[model samples]
Target: MITKGDGMGGARRHGGRPDLVRARVQQGMSQESAAQALGVTPTTWARWERGEQGVRASYRPRMAALFGVSAVEVERWIEGWSHGETSSWPTTDLGDSSPAATVKSAALLWRLEMDPSRRHLLASLPFVPSALGEWLVSWNYGTPAASAARRGAGRVVGLADVARINEARKAFGQMDQRFGAGLVRPVVVEYLNGTVAPLLRGHYDDRVGSELMTAAAGMTWMAGWTAFDLNRHGQAQQHFGQALRLAKTGDDPLTGVWALAALTRQAIHLEQGTWAVWLARAAADTARRAEAPPRVMSLILVKEAWATALQVKSAEIRDGRRAKQVERLLTEAERAYAKGTTDRDPEWTSRFEAAELNAEVGVCWRLLGEHRRAADCAEAAVTEFSERLPRSVQFNQVHAAEAYLGMGELEQALGTARAAIPVTKALTSARSVDLLQRFSGQLEPYGDTVAVREFRDHLNSELIA
Candidate 1:
């Protein structure tokens, strides 16, 4: 990605946002005149209008005054340039083709997410049912419409091909858990584009095609999950949306549940608690409507409870009923778990077992101020969760730290937080980094203490450096 002012010599006007250039033109101010008014060089002003230079924060008011607009409007212009909307900043040039072009789109979304100025654009997108409904409309009653076939007209595909796609998804999931999404996401995207896209284009019977679409949906959801873990939230959101379409095409309600649950998880991470709760509820409803297994229902309910817990503070203060509702959902999740038989669980759902439930429960308790219970559950999850799920273990450890901090056990809080540092330092998960940051925030009140200062320094060097 091209930083501001880097491509002044070769910068073109095609790719970036047009507001600045348009403003300059509409104001009828020659580049040199604008520079004179702004107390800058003609070249600098030219670069600014060309979207190749950042207008400093100090200059926003001046620039906005000159443009007869508010400083916030000027800031929006800068945000446009920063976000790659109008800039000719080169992104991953994956060539102009179906999967490759889509891959390039993914790269752009990832870049937009990484840019702090542009991230709000991703996080602020409303999680609306209309978007999901639009994707689902193409499903065509559980049949891959001929037009939906990749490669235009295609050859006979079989069950083996579908099985291979799912197996690859499983492999990617395992790699993601053991390492981090950064290690697995590119590979998954590449595989989806290079291998899976071609297979979807191939001809197959209705049964084979439906199975293939189901597998494709699962793979797409895995891609979205990895992207989410890597903090490319915009890309993840798009992938989840597409996965929903694929699931609908295959009549794969279970996979659709996965997509909605993943979306809910993303919403929660973004602190859009309302969307999270609604999406999770939608997932549970979809699961029931589709007659998904007991295990799937339990997973959805737990996810719903997690979302509800995030909303608990305000909801409890407002109506005083949300807390009880959340508790009821948690109990329902546990009852569903009791009814679930692991024998028929899919590879994806298998990870949503007792340890995960305990971790989610701990999270709910922590958020609700039940620190003692939260600490117990978190400690248990940290101890019992498999090493294969290193990222989750780090999260649980941090939750335990939060619980300790809430209970005023600073020493134990610091120790538990420090213990998770190695795990966090090794993983590329943004969520783990965010958890560590939250833990640091909990220590901010004790800034005068030696332990707090030392922990802060250690955190900066070990996790951030």
Candidate 2:
């Protein structure tokens, strides 16, 4: 069984929580009944009462409701029961900039994700937009020490081990892009916990260790991207933070920038435009500091454009200046992208080619109310993306359909949307499903039309099946 401890000899001793037992008894509920009410097994509940396991933050409110006490009181009781022991509950905090701390936190996160029960609590955690500021500040200024060789009980790691991780990341990343996160995320999480975590604890020289950390950071970023695609925002945020810390520990500024860009994408998706812009800017600054390749700079510029477009979308009035700013950023992104690939471009940069750039530009145009340009960009993206990339194809198709709807071409919109239905059905991405649902919402005004009605009927049926 997975044990709850700080991984630093802070494991909880056998200490019983008389207060919790009293609360349950006062409610006249057996342990089994309480566990059932709380949607956990009896053993887990018992562990909580016995201080063998710490209660997750997400479950505190439910426990409060069950015991007719405030959530704070439940937390106090838990703390009191623990008798000043360090709670081993998984946290999203990046911890200190130390290499050892980074490895410990990454391992903890992977374990939390691998545990079925803990993963459930993780999914329920809320996304905190406010946390972005602190994270960005830390990443921007925090300078971690260079990774050095470590003496450990595990096997010695070498360059070959790091290469294996990079290879696996590529294979898993391809699956994520084509099949969506729902199918690939769990496997990636398991791999992190079972394979990468062990290698991190193994002995390796500075060169091997740094390369290993960089490779691990890439995989962690992939895990975050998959979680984001699956709409697990909390999980995504934690993974991204961990990836950033890993990159810092590895002394890989470009990978750190990549993590920052992922956070910007999440912020944009959450509609925290200001935070998105800040993150994107930080990413660009870091890229320039690292002298990142033109392709990498292009990716960061597009993210900034997307974030700027969001700000424009949220404005009470059409902000022409901000709209123009977005256009300028996209133009710059195009120019940088045109500079083409270089030897310095990382393997991950290959995925953000013309199709991805156009798709993102299409989104910026859509947000700016330029439906004609958005439609053209979306169609170009759709044609450029390979059939293997079903999620991207469906996302762009949805954008195309939305652009048609904006243009009042209901038939064209319906046709474009219908084209995405098959791919949507096959993919497991929550984002794609959500996009289609949003498109359906846009069709509410045309509900009375026969074609719209029939299309909605077909879409609904396919979505449900």
Q: Write the per-residue lDDT of candidate 2 for residues 287-327, one digit (tens) a residue.
A: 99899999999999999999999999999999999999999
Candidate 2 off by > 4 Å: 1-88
Which predicted model would earn the best TM-score?
A: 2
Error of 2 at 361 (Å): 0.7
TM-score of each: 0.75, 0.87
Q: Give the total clashing residue pairs for model 2.
A: 0
Candidate 2 global TM-score:
0.87
lDDT values for all models = 0.72, 0.85
Report backbone clashes per prediction: 8, 0
- lDDT string for model 1 (1-465, tens) is 344343322223334546877888898978888889889899887777666666554565678789998544665565554332452232222122233233234344445444444333444333343454444333323343343233335466778888889889888888888788888877887777667776776766567766777787787788778878867666677678767666655556777788888888888888778888878877887888777777888888888888888898545374347777778888988898889675656567877878898889888888777899999999999888758689889999999999999999999999999999999888878878988998898788898999999999999999656
